[model samples]
Target: MTVGASVKQTLANLKGAQGTLRTYSIKVQDESARSIYAEALMTTNKVIDDLNKRLKTIELEEPQYRAY
Candidate 1:
């Protein structure tokens, strides 16, 4: 697949992982585990945001490669 497509797929997978983390955070009973999962979810969210910005830059720099 193309670079744009690959990046988009990675974004999708990250989002799915974020969802799973959120769900686990809510379901877990231990406070420490919950905190860890929540922190991880936040980090994943940041990565997703960064990837989105990079994707936008890529699209601008190469319109033909736009995958969104």
Candidate 2:
């Protein structure tokens, strides 16, 4: 319900989704397709990491207010 809790939940959800996508990519990528899959996975992971970092930064930078 709180902003901090919401941010934490969102980060956790992103991480979970990232892990699922990574597993699926690895399982589906063939010998010849591995390179493409790896590239996509890397890009996706980087974005997820960036998002999580931003969420944390916001959580830290913003002052918590009393919930009415």
Error of 1 at 50 (Å): 0.4
Candidate number with greatest TM-score: 1
lDDT string, candidate 2, 1-68, tens digits: 77666766776786777677677667874766666667777876787788767766766677573222
Clashes of each: 0, 0
Clashing pairs in 1: none
Off by over 4 Å in 1: none
lDDT of 1 by residue, 1-68 (tens): 87778888999999998999999999999999999999999899899999999888888888987754
Worst 10 residues of 2 by lDDT: 59-68
TM-score of each: 0.94, 0.54
Any runs in candidate 2 off by more than 4 Å, and if so which? 29-40, 62-68
